[model samples]
Target: MNTFLFSLKVMGIGLIGIFSVTVVLIIAMVILTRLFPVSAEKQDEESK
Candidate 1:
């Protein structure tokens, strides 16, 4: 029972770490995209 609880705690910590990193990465991607946005005209020109 003690080991089971310990494992659960570790798993919870790992989950939290993964969630935090994912959120950070998503925010970074959003900021980068906003800072250097791709225009529709550029895409249309490239499609030729």
Candidate 2:
């Protein structure tokens, strides 16, 4: 019983760690995409 409880605790911690990493990566990707947006073809043609 004790071993089962320990395994459960470990699994819970592992899940939380994974969730935090995923959230951080998603936030970073969003910030980067906003900072470097793609130009439209019309703008490119006008600039040339």
Candidate 3:
């Protein structure tokens, strides 16, 4: 039982770390995109 509980704690910590890193990366990407957004004209030219 003790070992199981410890394993659960470790798993939970890993999950939290993964979730936090993912959230941070998503936020960073959003900020970066906002700071340097693509123009509609550029997209239209690329589509041609």
C-alpha RMSD values across all candidates: 3.6, 3.0, 3.8
TM-score of each: 0.69, 0.70, 0.67
Candidate 3 lowest-lDDT run of ten = 35-44
What order do you get sorting by TM-score, best first? 2, 1, 3
lDDT of 1 by residue, 17-37 (tens): 999999999999999888767
Kindly report which residue pairs in candidate 2 clash with one another: none
Residue 28's C-alpha lDDT in candidate 1?
A: 100
By lDDT, rank the candidates, best first. 3, 1, 2
Q: Evaluated with TM-score, which candidate comes out highest?
A: 2
lDDT per residue (tens digit) for residues 7-48 in model 2: 999999999999999999999999988776676555777899
Q: Estimate the overall C-alpha local distance difference test score of candidate 2.
A: 0.90
Residue runs of model 1 more than 4 Å from their true location after superposition? 40-48
Q: Report model 3's TM-score to 2 decimal places.
A: 0.67
Residue 8 lDDT in candidate 3: 100
Q: Write down the TM-score for model 1.
A: 0.69
TM-score preference between candidates 1 and 2, better one: 2
Backbone clashes in model 3, listed as residue pairs? none
Off by over 4 Å in 3: 40-48
- Cα error, residue 1 of model 3, in Å, equals 3.9
